[model samples]
Target: MQQISINTPALLFPAITLLMLAYTNRFLALATLIRNLHTKYKQGQEDRNLLRQQIKNLRRRLLLIKQMQASGITSFFCCVLCMLFFYIGYEGWAYGIFGLSLGFLLLSLVLSLNEIYISTKALEIELKDME
Candidate 1:
C-alpha cells in the first residue's frame, strides 16, 4: 500500500464532525416527537391504534439514530487513530485504520438513510390519521 500522509485522515475531521452534528439534530427531533406523543397518549387525544403505530415507528427510528451516532463516533475515533498512527510512522497501520474509519462512515450513512425512510413513514402515518 502506498504511504498516506496524516493529512488524509485529518481531512475527515470536519466532515465527521458535521455528520455527528446532523445526527444529534435528528436525535433531538425524535426526542421532541416522543415527548409530544407521550403527552398525547396521556391525554387520550390520539386514536389507540394510531398511537400504537406511531410509537412503534418512533421506537425503530430512535434505535436507528442511536446506531447511526455510534457508527459515526467510531468512524471519527478511527480517523483520529489513523492520523495518530501515521504521525508516529506506522503507515500500514494508519492505512488499515483509515479503511475502518471509512467503513464505519459508510455504515453510518446507510443507517441515516434508513432512518429517513422510517421518518417519512411516520409522517405518512400522521397524514393518514388526518385524512
Candidate 2:
C-alpha cells in the first residue's frame, strides 16, 4: 500500500461538517412539524387516522435521522483517527481506518436518502387531504 499523507483524511473534515449540518437541519424541521401536529391534534382539527399516520411516518423519519447522525459522527471520528495513525507512521492502520470512515459516510448518506423518501411520503399524505 502506498504511504498516505495525513492530509488525505483531513480532506473529509469539511464534507462531514456539511453533512452533519444538513442532518441537523432536517431534524429541526421535523421537530417543528411534530410540534405543530401536536397542537392541531389537541385542537381537534385534523382527522384522527390521518394524524396517526403522519405521526407514524414522522417516527420512522426521526429514527432514520438519528441513525444518519450517528453514522456521520462515527465517520468523522474515524477520519480524525486515520489522520492520527498516519502521523504516527502507521500506514496500514491509517488505510484501514480511512476505509472504515468511507464506509460510515456511505451508510450515513443512504440513511439520509431513505429519510428524504419518507419525508416526501408525509407530504403526499398532506396533499391527498387537499385533493
Candidate 3:
C-alpha cells in the first residue's frame, strides 16, 4: 500500500485553524459586548443605552447563529466528501481531505454552540426587562 503524503493533511491544518479562529473571534466579540453591557448597567442611569446595546447584541448574535448553523451544515457535507475521497484516492488525498474536513466539522460545531449560547443569553436578558 502506498503511503499517504504529508502534504495532503498539511493543507487541511491551515483551513481548520482559520475556522477555529473565526469561532474564537465571534466568541471574544460577544464576551466583550456582554462585559460592556455589564459596565453600563452598573455605572450609569441611562437604561436606554443598555437596552440599545442589548438589542444590537441580540441582533448580531442572531445573525451569527444563522451563519454558524450554515457553516456547520457545510462542514458536515465536506466531511462526507472527505470520506468519499478516502475510497477514491485510496488512502492518500482522500484521507487528507477527511482529516481536514473533520477539523472543519469540529470547528463549525463549536461555533454553532457559541452562537446559540450568546443568543439564549440575549433572549434571557431581554425577558428580564419585560414590563
Candidate 4:
C-alpha cells in the first residue's frame, strides 16, 4: 500500500461539511412543513388521513436524516483519526481508518439519496391534491 499523506484525508473535510449543511437544510424544511401542517390540522383545514400520512412520511424522513448525519459525523471522526495515525507513523492503522471513513461516507450519501427520494414522493402527494 502506498503511504498516504495527511492531506489525503484532509481533502474530505470540505465535502463532508457541505453534505452536513445540505442535510441540515432538509431537516429545517421538513420541520417547517410539519409546523404548517400542525397549524392546518388545528384549524380543521387539513384532511385527517392525508395529514397522518404526511406525518408518517416526515417521520421516516427525519429518521433517515438523523442516520445520515450520524454516519457523516462518524466518517469525519474516522478521517481525523486516520490523519492522527498517519502522523504517528501507524501506517496500517491509518489505512484501515481511512477505509472505514470512506465506507461511512458512502453510507451517509446513500441515506441522503434515499431521503431525497422520499421527499420527492411527499411533494408528489401534495401536488396530487392540487389536481
The digit string of per-residue lDDT tens for model 2 on 38-80 reads 9999899999989989999999999999999999999999999
Tell me how far the alpha carbon of residue 27 in candidate 2 is from the true structure, in angstroms, after superposition: 0.3
Candidate 4 local lDDT, 5-51, one digit each (tens): 88999999999999989989988998999899989988999978788
Residue clash pairs of candidate 2 = none
* TM-score per candidate: 0.97, 0.97, 0.50, 0.96
Candidate 1, residues 19-99, lDDT tens digits: the string is 999999999999999999899889989899998899899999999999999999999999999999998988888999999
lDDT of 3: 0.64
Better of 2 and 4 by TM-score: 2
Tell me the lDDT of model 2 at 97.
96
Distance from true position, residue 51, model 2, in Å? 0.8
How well is each residue in 1-131 modelled by candidate 3, as lDDT tens digits? 54655354445545655765766676677778677776776787447855786868667785775576466556655655665666566665666656566666666677677767776777777677764
Candidate 1: regions farther than 4 A off: none
Worst 10 residues of 2 by lDDT: 1-10
List candidate 2 stretches off by more than 4 Å: none
Local distance difference test, each candidate: 0.94, 0.95, 0.64, 0.93
